[model samples]
Target: MKKLNISVIALAISLVFSTGVMAQGMSKKDYKADKEKIATEYKSAKAGCASLSGNANDICVAEAKGKEKVANAELEASYKPTRKTHYQARVAKAEADYTVANERCDDLAGNAKDVCVKEAKAAKTTAKADAKAQMKTSDANATANEKSTAARSEAKTEAADARKDAATDKLNAGYAVAKEKCDTLAGTAKDNCLNQAKRDFGK
Candidate 1:
């Protein structure tokens, strides 16, 4: 009787351990699958943007593709999944702002084009600000907990935002100058000139 009782106890313990291992394995597999799906979606979104044409279309497509890239990168990031989630949400909001600004650009001409570019610039600025805010929050949390890895991640995020902001500022400034020149022209020539400027400036 004693032997049988001991055998049963050993079998139960083995079963429980096996179940736990299987559960962990499943969780990892699920995470891997989710990451792949996000990447696939991002690729498809970018490809869809390629179909658009014209200045507004160009802006729309570029903004769409940019967001897609950001989304894919966030998915590939090594930080905790929760942090990735927060970053993606902020990126999405920024992308939405870009879309709205692009649409507003459609009605604009000359100085109005400059204004539209400024609107897009403002959207980008806000996005960078949001990213910085998130980084600060992450930094504070990491510092409080003394997590070197999290602090490093936050620093990297902030650096990326800074670089992006700098590039965008340069582009917008150039666009403003070009749009001013376009404003000096008149009629269809001005429209064509503005379109060319938008294309050349990658606006």
Candidate 2:
């Protein structure tokens, strides 16, 4: 049953990733419930391992724990749907695979075991690096978008100020033309024309 449980867990995990969007709309409560279910299953799976002994039993226990952890991480990622959480889920799977691979490596001897361990570590390293890179890229894009939004707002404010300044300059130029026309008159007539220009242009 332990072996079968492992198979089912692996299949479910595969399906979760393959389907890609199944976790998106899931509520936090549902995700939490699923988490409890996985934990209970992990305990049951571990209990089944008591029937075995030696490295066989160790491998079984490791697989159970790893699957439980990975499943929880994946579920959490779905619930929160953040870049960091998604990265964590991917990292969890990589670590789980590494643990299982290392346990399996115990079955080998000498150079074979050495090779298996190296391969397992390499796989974990590569997967972790990829996860980190993706998270960094996502973060960078988010930051750039924020900066771009700010820049656009700033540009809009600057443009508005420019238009206001241009309008003031245009009003002043019109007032200057009106004052010149008033200069052509004399006495009370010229004084009245200049007053009107000042009122109209707010000079």
lDDT of 2 by residue, 106-187 (tens): 8766545654565565556656666776676566555655788776566555555545554565565556556755756799
**lDDT, candidate 1, 1-203, per-residue tens:** 01111122112111111122222223556546655665565567557766776655665555555554444444333233455555664565556555545554665665555655555655555565656556555655656456577676776666666656656665666576567667768999999999998998897
**Model 2 reaches what TM-score against the true structure?**
0.61
TM-score of each model, paired residue for residue:
0.42, 0.61
Q: Which ranges of candidate 1 are over 4 A from the true structure? A: 1-28, 46-52, 56-60, 73-79, 82-107, 141-203
At residue 156, candidate 2 shows an lDDT of 56
> Can you give the lDDT of residue 71 in candidate 1?
43
RMSD of each: 20.5, 29.7
Clashing pairs in 1: none
The best candidate by TM-score is: 2
